[model samples]
Structure formats: structure tokens, C-alpha cells
Target: MNTPHTAAPVARLAAATAAIAHQKRWFARMREEVAAGAPLALVNADAPQEILRAMGIPYVVNQWWASVVSAKRMGPAALDSVAARGYPDDSLQYDAIGLGSMDLPAADVPWGGLPRPDFVIAECGADATRKVFDLWAEHPGTEFFPFERSSATTAPDNWWEIVPREWERAYAEDRLDLMTSENWQLVDFLTERTGRSFDIDRLAEVMALVNEQAEWNRRTRDLLAATRPTPVSVNDSIPAVMIPQWHRGSVWGRDAARALFQEVEQAVRDSRAVCPGERVRLMWIGRGLWFDLGLYQRFQEKYGAVFVWSMYLAIAADGYARYGDDPMRALAARFTGFTDQLYTPPLSSQWYVKEARSHGVDAVVHLVADDVPGSAFTTEALEIAGIPVLEINADNADSRGGAAAALEAAIGDFLERRVLG
Candidate 1:
């Protein structure tokens, strides 16, 4: 928690970061809803949130809950729960962390404990996500639903351009068709169980709101990319952009996006510098540094370095937009290969290189998760594009006991010997 320089707390943070507390209250309300006999879902990050949103079912994202567990430093105890259940604690730490915590005592659980899920939905990714959710479904009242995650067949050089309008060309037709059909099955399954009919009109409305939120995020990202000395920190941007993202396809999420855009624009107008001594503009790749977010600002005084970018905000701008008459088809197009664009071969490489250039990042710090594919290609692409990369191999959530100290030392070494020197 030690920072080199304690800059004056900026007003930008106050306006942009309502999601921190809002999410807690949101989770608590969801628990209440589930306890009162309402059907609740536990879904993967890539699972279709819009479907649940439109159905009026309360749900909690598995990864969001994993983050809460990791942030509270209860990751070890949670993993112990996994180990007690005869599962290997090391494998799929990010996806399984929440499952392990599910059996913990209420006093030990994060966010007042996650209510048991009625529906557990996830895509088959990394050879582990579906299995993790399958285990969750083994609980008495939960039902498991899974879809396939296809590899990237098309590598559009700049995904931000075509994905919004021409996504059919950006991704293969088979992928979208398969996902759309699966969504139909999912809709049928939910209808048979919950007795609530799926409404296409409502889904279309959700898609529209999601697009609006993405547009505002696009504005905020572009503003950050164009600004000198960096108007806002990635630490701040992560919550501002991602909290709304987790609750996407709602009026509140879209409004949050607009609020974030306006807040960043005002910071630019005021010529705010997160680190006034800013010299190195850094780009953080992979999942968030949830263990120690203050790590983003650690080298500010000594190295004049500031982390200006993280995928949480940038992907929001370019990743979530789809426009079409059929809401199911559109939603399928939105998530069919969403993770592929960031973690697959040519698509992942091309997009990261594009982002590094657009952000004018002086250096890159790539956190390579054990279960995620394609970190080597991403690093190679950035280096080939002439941007220096420091690969930190660790789980952003589990921390592996000493991962925080290791990351801190490695980044300091990277900045001194490679970047600043």
C-alpha cells in the first residue's frame, strides 16, 4: 500500500468511480433476491449477460466474485476449500476460486457470500471454464449449460473498425450460427424452467443500450489515447469502465459510461496529469492487477512512470458493439469469438500492436496467466512492432503467495534497466 508520491486526490476519481460501492450493493441485492425464491444465475465473463438482464433474472458473474475473493486476500482459504473437495488447487485458479469459496462460512466469504446459483452457464474455454461451472452445477439445485469456444479463424488487422458493423466478415459464419442456435436452446431451457418467456424486443433494447455504452467508452478511450501526459490513471479507468461493463445492457450501465466519458473529457480540459513527472507511458496487458492496484502508481516518483492503459477500458471501446435486426444473432456475433480477439494468435497479436501504437505506450507489461493461451505471440507482436515488453507470469487473482513481490521487483527492474536506462 506504499506509494512513492501521494498526489492530491483528484475530483475526477470521485465522479468516475461509483461502481466500486455500487457493485457491492448490487451483489447484496442479488443475494436478497435469490433468498426470496427468485431464480439466480452464476455465469462466466464471456457468457451472455444480456439474456439474463432481459429476462429479469438476477445473476452474479463468476470472475467478479473471484476478484472480490482475491482482493480480500481470502484466495488461499478459498483454494483450500477446492483442495478439500479433491480438486487440484493450482489448475484454473481464476475460474475455480469462486467455487472454492462457495462452501466457506459466511464470515469468511467475500461480499457477504454468493448465493447458490439456479443456472450455471459458461462457454468451453481454456479446457477448464466449463468443467469449473460443471462442478458448480453438481450442487443440488443448479443446472449447467455450456457452449463451445471456437478458435480464431479470421484475424482482422484492426478489429475496432469492422467489428461494430461488419462482424460477419470479422468472424466466421459457422461460429455465429452455432452460438445463435445455442442461445435459442438456452432461451428454451430458461423458459421451461423459469416459466418466463424470452422477449426478442427486450433483448433488442438491451443490445441498443449496450451499444450506447460502448460508444461512450469509445469516446473516453480516444480521449485518453490523444491526451498528453495522461489525464487519468489506468487504476481509475479499470473500475470506471469495467463495473459498468459487468452490468452492461442496462440504463444505469449506459449512464455510467456517459459519466466516465464526461469525467475523462473534463480531466483533459483541465490538463490533469496523473503523474506530473510523467515520462514513461505504460500499457498493461492481460487481466487486472487486482491484488495490488496501487502497483500502477508505484514508480511514479522515482521513474516518472505511469500506467496509462489497461484492456478493461480499451476493449470496452472496441469490443462490445453489434448492430442488427435480430437480437439473438447480434448477441451471438458479439460474444462468439470475443475472447479469441484478445487471446488467440493473429487476432490477439494484431490488436495489441494496434493498441500499443494508438496509446503511444513507451513500454508494455504483459501479465501471462497460466491457463490463458497466446501470451508468447502477443509479446512477440509488440516487440516486432518495436515496443518493449516485460512478461510477468502469474495469476492476477491467486497471486501464488509471493507473486506480488515478484511482480513489483520485476517491473522495477524492467523500468530501470530496459525502459528508463
Candidate 2:
């Protein structure tokens, strides 16, 4: 299930963490600039910053939308959103409730209650997310769709290696316009009101945060992998990773990782956990549980196995950033282009193996998707490392099928064979 819990030597992740806390007032102040009467717009699940730029509207990002879908808060409401919003019951995502909340309308939900946005911008980036807005207009609310076809899988260049230029042309030309024209227009529209000053210091701060957060994530993942509880539950990590998408570029992400790192340290020092004493370590690859965190805990409880690592937040911290004289362009390079977090090659998973070895994990849960290629190759690599992997066919969010049950049984059997056989 896991190793004996041990204390980790943690380094100061980044000075930006302190800066973010100090500057939190700015984020709050930005929110205050809006008072419902202002020129604002809203989008269900779609990023308001992007669409607001497209429409020339000033609006706040959906703070509440991001929070509710976080690991700790997602529950039955997550399921309701999935089924009602027309998400593939088999797909994993967070936009259903985020976008579904949009259909509720500003007048109905109210700003005081849930930040009533002025308008909605929808994007069809993921097939599941695409349908989120289709239901929004039916609510009699005003909304706009994104240049989706071109942008959905275009961020990372690795996607082209899998799908090729023809598919990109078909998708981008037919449904979305990801050409520089749209991006230039989008930038021109927002650069004025958003008041995006090119702050080199800020770029440096974000870069430090990215590096620190990456180290912290690797450390804590190792801590979790090495230690376990009497009963391992996926819920152990739900709160730390799930809720903080807004904080991705900020220090909050590192703080969360640091706190978890300390938490597991305490657990190990006290010998207060059960999973840590066990011999099974699990690595979750791909998108995490956005809707139902309970599933994570359920598996943990059953197997004494703890999921110490995942790629979403892990890859973000690892892939994003660079220390440079010109940080704005570097920051742009990190995000505007794409790195394959999902699936194009085994190199990403090679990093995972190195991390797994550092963390001393026992196995992996490979959630395969058509969008990602060469996944099986990575799965084989993890296995060859002597960490038996369970290949699962299910979306990260949706868990309605027997696939999960079978996967669980397979995991149980795998562990049983390891521990008792």
C-alpha cells in the first residue's frame, strides 16, 4: 500500500507565494471594480477573460464556478450537472456545472449569491464542454460560442503529431478560427481595459512559483506515495488539487501543495496513518476527479493504496515557465504553445516514471482516451519498471460504468496478489 511515512526536506518554493498573499487585495480589488451595473459579461464554464475580450466586455472570472467544482465541494451537484448539461456520462470534466450555472441567469442566481455575470461565452474545446453552452441559450440567456474547432487541441504542438495538419485544417477552418487574426483581435480588445502592463517582475514571480510548485508537487506526491492510512481513500487529495484552478498561475497552488506535504509529514512522523505502512503506491495519470472525489477515497479505503501523483497539476508546474530577461514572451511561450499533458508520446510518461521512482510508487492507473496516443507504451514502461499498472477505460470525471468496478476489482486483485500471494 505504501512506505513508512518520512519527513521531507522542503525548500522555499518561491518568493511569489508571499507576494501573492500580500497582493490578494488586488484580486479582491479587481472584483470590486464590478458592481452589476458595470459593463460585464458571463460564460458558462468558458473562461470569461477570453470571451469578454472577444465581445469587448469587462467581467470577472467565474470564481464561484471554479470553486464548486473543486475537489472538496464536488458531490451530487457534480453528478446533476453532468447528466443535465448533456455531458457524456462517460466523459470527465468540470464545465457542466460551471456552464450549467450560467443557464440559471444573473437575475435568478444574483451577484450576491453567485456573482451574476453580464453575459455568457461558451467554447467547444472538449466535446463534453462544447455541449455545455448549447443548453445555455435554451435558458433564454444571451451567450456566444468560441472559435472552438481551431483551439480545442491546438495549444500543444504534440497534438499535430497524432492528428496531423488535415484534421487541424478541418477543425480550425470549419468551426473555429485559431489563426493569429483572432488572437491578435482578442489581445487588442482586452489589452486596453484589463490594463495588462508588461511586468517583468511579475513574470519572474510566476516563473519562480511554477518551479517551486513543481518541486513541492513532486515532494508531496512522493510523501503520499510513500505513506498511507489504515484505509486509503481518494478523498485524501481531493481538496488540495481540485478547487484551485484560479490559483494555477498564483502562489496558492504551491501553498496547497506545501500544506499537503506538511500534512503527510505529520502523519508519517506520528505513525498516525495506516496506508503509509502498507506496500501499495498508485499513480493517477491524466485528468483528475473534478466531479466525484469520493471515488478516490473509495479506492484508497479498499486497497490501502494511495494515489501520490497525477499529471494535470504535476505537468503544469513542470511544463510551465522559464527564467529569462524577457518574461512576458517566455510566459506566453509556456501557455500559447502546447505541451502534451494528455497524450502524444511516451516522453511525458518517461518523466512520470522518473517521478514514480523518486516517489517509490508501486503501480499506475492509466485512464486512456482517444484524444491521447501512445498511452499504452507508457503503461508498458511503468509496468516494466516493475510497477504493475491497471489500464482503465473511463473518463476522469464520469464513473457510471462497470469499467470502474472492474478496475477496482483488478486493483484489489493486483494488490492482493502482491501482499498475500
lDDT of 1: 0.86
Best candidate according to TM-score:
1
- Error at 58, model 1, angstroms: 0.7
lDDT of 1 at 260: 87
Q: Each prediction's TM-score against the native?
A: 0.96, 0.62
Tens digit per residue, CA lDDT, model 1, 1-421: 1122323434447544488888878888888888899998888889998998999988888888888898888888888999999988888888999899988899988778988889999988866776788899888899999988877777777777888888889889998999999999988889899998888999999999999999999999988888767878787888888889989999999999999888877766666678866789999998987778878889888898989899988889989999988889989999997898888878878888988898899999999888878999999999999999999888888866788888989999999898989
Per-candidate Cα lDDT values, in order, are 0.86, 0.48
| lDDT for each residue of candidate 2 in 228-296, tens digit (9 for 90 to 100) | 442223444433443333344456666766765666565556555434434466677765654454455
| Clash count per candidate | 0, 26
- Which regions in candidate 1 have their CA more than 4 angstroms from the true location? 1-12
Q: lDDT of model 2 at residue 88?
A: 52
